[model samples]
Target: MTHTIAVAPQATKHPGPLGRRPAPQSVAELLLRAEALEGFTVAQLAAALKLELPLHNRRAKGFVGGLVEQALGADPKARTQPDFPALGVELKTIPIRPDGTPLESTFCCAIAMGRADRASWEASVLRRRLDHVLFVAHLAVKDTPLAARRFARPVLWRPTPPQWQLLQQDWEDLMGKIGAGQSGHLAANVGEILQVRPKAAHRQVRTWGHGPDGPQAVHPLAFYLRARFTRSILRQQG
Candidate 1:
């Protein structure tokens, strides 16, 4: 079945609730600020930030993360790098069940199907993006209204040595095929923890990529961390 990706633009930024508290100087400062809002509901934070909460959330897919970013005073110019590049931290807002299990996969990064990337695992965009992440979770029960969803505990995390191995292996496997014009054959189950999925903003969106028959139109792809893996990261929260 085809997925209709939402293209509705997010509302423009308004003055932050804290009047743009000076950008976080250190990781400690960032976490402290994030933790302070651990129990705030979406309504409370949105009101504070002057955001007009939407009546229907279908067009607000990344709304929560944007709210948290503004709350923490993230710089808008650094969209291509980690959300908080000053502290080498990527801000990720994950939705979780009331019991702490993730509700869906966490978006990792986009893949340029036709472009060559760094061969070194340590130098890859995905590696740097996942290097240091500040995860702020929110309760996402199906029946819960968006405004009433509470921000849960925040966790600062970096993958362990063992975890990195698995991730790197999957990265190699996927990139190998993607680089070799075999993208058409990659199944959804190709990776153990990381998976590549189409990331278009609409059903008909397409991009250039290699296939067995050489360059061809391909579905744009983005990497995602399976919910099972994210649940483990939250479990290991420090």
Candidate 2:
């Protein structure tokens, strides 16, 4: 039997019973709001906010992220910066399997391809994104409908000394490639925990990147945290 949660109109996009939550003033207020949603299933969330879930995976992937932004009062436009600029915090929704392990890699932020060569670890985009993150772990097993998935406890993660070391090391290594104009040769297997992959829906999309021959067309690379790293964070929190 397929156990699914009862949801409101699946086609609706307007604010529903819960309407929309106000922007949290402080980190305390934000966590209070997040705590209220700790155990709620996706259906309950969508039903309350009257959000529509896309039928397709590509569209659904972004819709779920938007749903979190709406619920958390973060502006999607400022994704280049942190989700909540006021609090200097970023909100991330991690899909976890039964054992509380991440089902996939977590998207960190976009790469500054042009200036990556000289970008310092202290001012790197990855560093800023990881500075303070609100990680909302959701139950995301295969075959489970998006609406039926439940959200687990949210973890507020700040890197410790060792965690910082790991990220800095990866950043420096990846930066070396970009600096040397060898970004064209970067593979998914380059970094230990932080890796870069093209951020496009198809092969046709391309972006200008520094190449050995000067400037060349290449896939737009973005930062991603390996599942193992995120799993470690959750385990440590527990």
Q: On residues 1-238, what C-alpha lDDT tens digit does candidate 1 reach at each position?
A: 3221111132233223663556799999999988777767777788887778888866444888888888897877776588888888988898887667887888988888886332556677789889898888887778888987777878899989998999999998898888788777778788999998878888588898777777888888888999889887887672
* TM-score of model number 1: 0.88
Model 2 over residues 110-204: C-alpha lDDT tens digits?
88777776789988878988999888777777888887676677778899998889999999999889867887788888888999888887988
TM-score for each of the candidates: 0.88, 0.88
Off by over 4 Å in 1: 1-16, 116-119
RMSD of each: 7.2, 5.2
Question: Residue pairs in steric clash, candidate 2?
Answer: none
Residue pairs with backbone overlap in model 1: none
TM-score of 2: 0.88
lDDT of 1 at 10: 27
- In terms of lDDT, the poorest run of 10 residues in model 2 is 2-11
